[model samples]
Structure formats: C-alpha cells, structure tokens
Target: MDTQQNTALTRALAEVPGPLPARGVIHIVIPHTDRFTVVGNHLAQHPGLSTTAVGFAVRIQSLPQGTEIGVKALAARFPEGEKLIAAALRELEAIGYLQRARTRLPDGRIVTRTVFCNQPSALLRLPKAAPHQPATPQAPAPAPTPRPVPALPFPLQPIPELEPTLQPVQVLTTAPQSVPAPAPKPEPLPPLATTPECAPAPPPQQPAAPRFVPLVPPPTAPKLPPRPLPQPCELTPELHRAATALLADLRRHTPEFTLTEVDIQQLAPAVAAWLEREARPDTIRHVLTNDPPQPLRHPAKLLRHRLTVLLPPPLPGAHDLAVPVRRVTVTPFQTCDGCERAFRSSMPGRCRDCRTDHAQAAA
Candidate 1:
C-alpha cells in the first residue's frame, strides 16, 4: 500500500510545476489556536544556536508558568538524556533566552527558578544604528552591447543604432565664505627684574634605620592538660566483690587482659566509679576484654585507662522520666496548579485530592 501511494505521489508531483524536492525544505504551515508559541525569527533561524537549543527554547516558551522544565524532568519526558538537555539549556542561557536563579527556602532547601524570554533583544540592548548620510549622485551606467542573432533560412534586415540623448548638466554653486578678522598689534614687553623670586627647598629627609625581623617561629597554642581520671567512689563490700570478680573474669574472654590479684585490688576502685555512674556489667566487660592490644603489657594499666576514658555520666533528673522524640517532615511545600492551594509534595503539580478528582473526571 505504501509503495503504491509513493508511486502515485511521484506521478502527480512530476506533472505539477513546482520547486524540486532536493532543492530545499518545503514548509506546510498550520495555524494553532489552542496551544501555540510565538518564536522570533532571530532564535528560530539563529546561526549560532544548535537545533536542540532552539527546540528547547520553543518548548520552554510554550509551557505555562510554574511548569517544571528542569533537566531531569525534561529528560524523563523526552528521548534526550539529561546531559544533552543540560547542554541545550546552557546554550539558551548563554544567548539570554533562558535564566536560572537559585533561591533558598525557609526550610533550608535550595531550589532553582527558571525564567524564559521569547525575545532576548527586548531584555538585552542592541547595537545603535549608524547615522544617516546623504547619498552622492552617480553617473548613469552604459548599456551592454546586443548579442548577434543566429542566421535563419530566410534573409534578415540589418538593425540601425539609436543615438544617445543629451542631458542638461546642473552646475553646483559654492557657498560664500565669511571675511577674516585682522590680527591685533603686539604689546611691548615689561622690563625684567634684577632679582628672581624663588620657592624654599623642602627639608632633607633622614634615612630610616634598617630594622631586622627576627626569624622566630609562629606562637603555638598552649597544650591542653590531659583529662583527669575518674575519682574512685567510697569502697563498699558488695562493690569490691563485684569489681574484683569482673577484673578476674576478663582473662576468660581475652587472655591478653589477664590481671593479677594485686592489680585487681588496685583497679577495683576505678571499676566501682564506673558502677556508681550506672554503667552495666556487660558494657564494662565488653569495653575491657572485647579487643585488647597485641603482646599485652600492663593489663591493669590498660583496664584503668579504659575505665577512666569510657566512663558514662550519671542520669539527669528522675530515671523513670521519658523524653519525647521530635519528628520533622522534610517534604517541600508545593502550590497546586489546579486548586491553587499549598500542599506538601516531593514534586510540583496538583494536590492529592485535585489529582484524584482530575483522574476520576478523565476516566
């Protein structure tokens, strides 16, 4: 069917007297009323702008205000990827057809606002026109010689030359010049004074002393004193027994953390301080015996250091008191295009209800 249609189209086109198909593009204009964009010839036929950029500009201009024309949005809607669309947008921006401004929201989010201009020249100034000058009168050009006609079967008569017409020349008149004024006579010079007046000379400046900058290193900040180890709480029989058992059991989990009885008595106070802060036995055991340094030297000192550094602060207020957790909804507020109402949406468009209603109506 397509082949037959093509053959018929070719036959009809051959019979008609019109421009050749290979010569150039033939435009078939269709007037649009419902949806249309008025593009300037300067942008449509721009020598510098690429085809993608020109098309992108037209698409943007046709879109209603507040419509999403972002790179990602356009890439999703069109076949071209984000990179090509971004390049086209940049091209349009460079030519003053598109402008993007970053705006920060009250919620600490930054968004880009785009403004499209159909006529860039209206926004940017154009070059001024050159001042008009009167045209100089030029002599008429001579006519070209007639070409000889080919010999025909019958004899032809010789043609006669017509004489050129004489035109009257208008002589130009020059404007009169104004008379020159006479020069005034020179005045006599005054007599010269015997003594000349002179300005006083400035006082001689003394050379500044060559001061030397000492090559001293920059002042360093004072080192902070190491944090003091947690003070041992008052020893109790139960606390002493529990602390001793915890220290003795450390070697079961990690052999490197083995401590002697003398070391246990010495470090027991530090563990008691941790227990006073309400740290759990499991947490304390995990801190000491979970991961010990290789070739352990001074297990008691390592235990003492961990107890001091990893001590937890006492609970504030009543232990039974409950603290409320704050939940922040980070969704951005969007103005619905249909209802013109503000609503929280990750993307811009109609609100949920409006969208549902529209979908039902369409269905």
Candidate 2:
C-alpha cells in the first residue's frame, strides 16, 4: 500500500532470474515453486510490462485460503485486469487461465459460480532486471529548518522631526471673445407635388475657365422585369377531392358541429384544405397524436430472439400433485397501432393503412 512496498515489489520482480523475452506475442510461464507465484499478463494491459496481469493473478493463486476467490475480485486487484477486466479476461482466456471445464444453465436459468476459465487469467510473472546491472539507488531525506529569534519586547523606536509649509498670492485681468461667420447655405426644398415652382433663378457669376467638355452616357445591359407573387386559395384537383371525401365522412358521423378542433378524424382533411387554399402548410403540431416522436425501430435492424424449452415455467400444483396434467407456457403478444389491439406479429412497424394515410396527411 505504501510507496516503499510498491518499490520493493517492483525491484523484486526486476531482480528475479529469467530468460530473455522474444519479440511480439511473448508467452511466458512462471513456475509456482511456492515462495512467489508467477503472474502472466497481456502485453496490452501492461503495455511496457515484462510480466502481465494474468501473471499477477497466478501469483495470488499461491495464497492457500483465497485460491477459490471469485474471478471478479481477482480481476479487480491484478494489474492486467485492473485497467480493463473485460479485455484482461479475453487475453487471459486466450493464454490459458482456465483449467476447469465451463458449463452453462438452460435458457432462463441462473448461472453458477464454479468457473474454470475457458480463457485463462493473466498469470503472475517475475519482474525482470537488466542483465548485470548495478543495484538501484535509495532516495535521501530532507533537512529541517531552524527557528527565528524574537523581536525586542517593549521600547518604542525614536520619532523623526518634521519640515516647513509655503504661502499663496493672486492677481486680476479681463477679456471676451467673438466667433467667425459661417458660409452661405442652400435653401431646403419641399416635395415635388406639394411645393409651388419659383420663377427660374438667375445663374450665379462664375470663375474663368479655358475649355468646355461634352457629356456622354455610360454602357449597361437591359434589365429583366420582376415576376409577380402567387396568392392564396390555389388548389390542385387531387387535394380538393381528398378534402371533400374527409368532410363527407364527418357529416355522416355528426349532424351538428363546429370545425374548430383537429384530431385524426378532423385534422387530416382540414390540413389538406389548408394546404390547397394556401401555399404554406398549417403547423404540423396541430395534428394531435400521442405517438412517440422517435423512429419505432432501430433503423434496418431485425429482432433475433431465441426460443428455448429451458425458458418455460412448470405447471402449478402438478409438480406435487398425484394427478397428471398438461403444462401451458404463455408469452405476451405485441400489438397493432391502427386497432389498439394485440396481434401475433408487428412486422410492418405500424398499422397497414398508416403508411398511405400519413404520407397524404403530411403532404
């Protein structure tokens, strides 16, 4: 648990005698000769480790009392499994952590505890030292600081003398300022239709010029005319017919009614009429559906359920009763959205007419 202990374990592993490891997929087997058990681990869990987490698990195996410890606890404590138990288990199993044959319960039955891994736990391996290297150095201790002396208990330090101040004076005088004239301004004009015309104004006297110039128009392409916007109440023949059919069905169902609300019975035709009359659609939220907003299926995936006899429950009283009776097994049925009733298969995902009706309504 302490740094020194961890260091000692690392040194012990490093100092142990061992053969040189081969490059890539190194398979190591540490003999369980007793004092320290060998641990083997996946290279991945201990990326730079010479020994693996499985190797550590094997080392723990030498403890006589905890030999039958759960794979889960062992997986947690060991180096290889510490980082990733699932990945460690996979590698260990591949490397042969399991010796006992593994078995399974029938479908719907609980799994048992006794497991010899189909995969091995990464075994404990001896840590390796560099061949012929000097011993590792120990860290030195830090030195302590000395205490400071106390200041004089009571006498106040002597105060210093102060310096002189200067006198003030004032004098008088007066004056005022004038602003420059602004340039001549142009008179504002009123709107062409509202204001009356003035008698043609005389041209202002001009400064002398040497020459006069002629004016000319710049080049440009002809402009295209703008298109007119469409108005509401433009309906296609098909949309009108659908709306008509829907309204007729409503008339048959109720004689006296105001068409203010929209449901499946009301919304479909009303939405159609709104679309036909106006270019824009009425809000989709107006159609009231309690259906979930997400896709009903995990896109493109199919259900693959296994039906097995082991999953069945026993007949009540028959197991202890003398009289013989047949046992029946029951599974809940899936349902159809269109009819709010149970059915054997829901393959189409929605009720049969849902596809056609939804498309038309959405459009």
Structural similarity to truth (TM-score) of each candidate: 0.29, 0.18
For candidate 1, lDDT tens digit of each residue in 242-291? 88898898888777887888998878888888887778888999987767
The CA root-mean-square deviation of candidate 2, after full C-alpha superposition on the true structure, stands at 41.4
lDDT of 2 by residue, 90-202 (tens): 44444444333345767756544433331232222323332232222221333233222222344333322111111111112132233223333323332222233442443
Measured with C-alpha atoms, the lDDT of residue 160 in candidate 1 is 26
Q: Pick the candidate with the highest TM-score.
A: 1
Instruction: Give the lDDT of residue 59 in candidate 1.
Output: 84
Tell me how many residue pairs clash in candidate 2.
28
The per-model lDDT (C-alpha) reads 0.71, 0.39
Clashing pairs in model 1? none
Cα error of candidate 2 at position 282, Å: 24
